[model samples]
Target: MLVFAFQISRSGKSTYLQQVCLVVILAQIGCYVPARFATIRVVDRIFTRMGTMDNLESNSSTFMTEMRETAFIMQNVTNRSLIVMDELGRATSSSDGLAMAWSCCEYLLSLKAYTVFATHMDSLAELAT
Candidate 1:
């Protein structure tokens, strides 16, 4: 369910969103069925903000890791769960990123599953407007 909305700056909005999601997940501890039984998806794009240099010796770029993680989430997400996504297109070109983000949003909404997608893409906000 879409809960409350606040009017802080963009940074604060993002932070609060993360915190709220965390709290909700925590609050669900005793209430939800076994996690494996629940079918919610959390889709955060890896490497959306920080670089993926932790495995430099293994030669895994942030972009590749991000793509892999996104693909994995999309593939594994169940229909009965919530999705929490971060910046969806931060690793690609602006236009490409926006397109991917838009399409993902459409897909999630199509599923009628609870989703919380966080993005720096202003165009997405336009969709809500």
Candidate 2:
């Protein structure tokens, strides 16, 4: 599920992603969810990536930190993983970010993991098709 909330739209994309991941987690643990209906898949791991954050101590910029986290996710994820990522390429040039995000989206899709990506970049939504 790729959500395109649009840049600076602030349509609660992050919140929606969080809720979905939470619901999946709750259902996975055999806990009663508040929803009327749910079909939770068997997930071995739940990975979430948020917006940019500078690794100042390590002398890394915000974009570099974001890339590092994304790299870690790509390397570690499996088909049984549930990946809820938000704004993977937010702190760089629009073209660069879009390109990187697009590639990341493709790679994630190829892995066949249950993924929910929330992005402000509208172009990334094309992956939904």
Using lDDT as the measure, which candidate wins?
2
Q: How many residue pairs collide in each prediction?
A: 2, 0
Residue pairs in clash, model 2: none
Q: For residues 45-119, what per-residue lDDT tens digits would candidate 1 score against the true structure?
A: 211122233357667666676667667656655555556666666777999888977876676666654666666
For residues 1-129, what per-residue lDDT tens digits would candidate 2 score against the true structure? 333445464778888888888888888888989889877888898888886678879999998888888889899999888888888777988999899989988887788888887777887767878
User: Model 1, residue 116: what's the lDDT?
Assistant: 66
Candidate 2: C-alpha RMSD to true structure equals: 1.9
TM-score of 1: 0.65
Misplaced by over 4 Å in model 2 are 1-8
Candidate 1: stretches off by over 4 Å: 1-10, 31-58
Cα TM-score per model:
0.65, 0.88
* Worst ten in a row by lDDT for model 1: 43-52
Q: What is the lDDT of every predicted structure here?
A: 0.57, 0.81
